[model samples]
Target: MENNRVKKQPPKKNLWKPEEDLILKKYVEAHGEGNWATVSQKSGLKRGGKSCRLRWKNYLRPNIKRGRMSQEEEDLIIRMHKLLGNRWSLIAGRLPGRTDNEVKNYWNTHLNKISPLGKRKHVDSNDQNNTNSTETTNKKSKIHTYPVISIDAQKNPTKESNGKKEEGSTSLLNPLMTDTKSFSYDTESPFIATNTSTFFFDDEPLITYMDSFALFEGFGYTTGENYAELGMQLVSP
Candidate 1:
């Protein structure tokens, strides 16, 4: 009975060849975009209209930027992401020569990992928990916290009076070092530094510290009483 109920699977999609690609490209070039259904039928390709449309828009489109995104493009993507969320098509419109699929892929592969807002949302979602003793105990036992540090390299390192490289000086602290920008130490051990200039701190300790500082600043509390109250709230059961 189980074997009889099993459904037959569909055949695999045909792998597009260079000649098929050329035919599709020439068809679109001669006729111009749209009418993909007709193009698919007339081009003699086994792929569907949607597939042809995506191939043309994402790969065959003229002036499409194919390399790694520039700093400016990355910044724009970050800002646009914040404003528009995951509306990739809308975001792609703001970035000239970039396709929606490219922007979406970049965000998923790269930006999402480094995005502070994304991390904060993830942390907040995970932080929401019941206050029951058993639940709290289970959550706390499972939680693995690690130290995170953010280090900002001074834009200009102090130079030697003699204008000569100091003996035994490394580039990590060298003022003249032009490549490294900023770096972060995270939950992962042995943090690897990069050639960027901005650093982000995503650890719970840093977030707690920032929250406390903000609360203190907002309340304009200069007295020990306020500090005591704040400390109590932070440690309260």
Candidate 2:
């Protein structure tokens, strides 16, 4: 620095003007859009190729659906947000004539506050209140006791000729004593009945349909091995 060596200054960024835009558009129209660096050089614009390309794509692109989003578009954006979550590029890809920048801006301005996560919190709070009320009611109500008949396998245990207990000697609950209905896998007895049609592969529709039935109260079903041991509480409403 003491030797008086002058430092090289960076070139100033080109401030885009209407004339430059016209030149870029004219060049693109003539060549039908290929090689942006070549286009920038040929267009005689001071801006870089990337900057020109971005300006053209985001602003000057033809058939871009501008103005306020429709109700259908808003609903689609909400659903896509739930599935994709802030992946604006991917979301924009699904929405025709919409840009990632537009989607991101819209989400930031509007959808962030009334998102599904916020709605879920409201629903959960309401459910908690309902549960508290139900608990209070249950505490005040008279509790009725039911007899539990436990059929022990050891009482009349199945044994081999050597006096060892057989492998199949497992305790079973007496069907007559309990309020619950037992369905055999071999039989075609319907455990759940619904008028609504449900796809065989999709469990959601079937579960939703069954949830409407008031016969089974305070019971939940899980997937895999836990599903086999579904407990039904006989609650008289």
TM-score of each: 0.45, 0.42
Question: In candidate 1, what residue range of length 10 has the lowest lDDT sum?
Answer: 165-174
Reference-based lDDT, residue 141, model 2:
30
How many clashing pairs per prediction, in order? 2, 0
Off by over 4 Å in 1: 1-15, 116-237
Task: State candidate 1's TM-score.
Answer: 0.45
Residue 135 in model 2: lDDT: 20
Cα lDDT tens digits for candidate 1, 123-169: 34354542211112343433323222222323222223543322211
Instruction: Report the Cα lDDT for residue 48, model 2.
Output: 83
Q: CA lDDT of each candidate?
A: 0.51, 0.46
- The predictions' CA RMSDs to the true structure, in order, are 18.6, 22.0
Give the alpha carbon lDDT tens digit for every residue of 52-116 in model 2.
88767766667577888777567666655543355465556545577788887787677765743
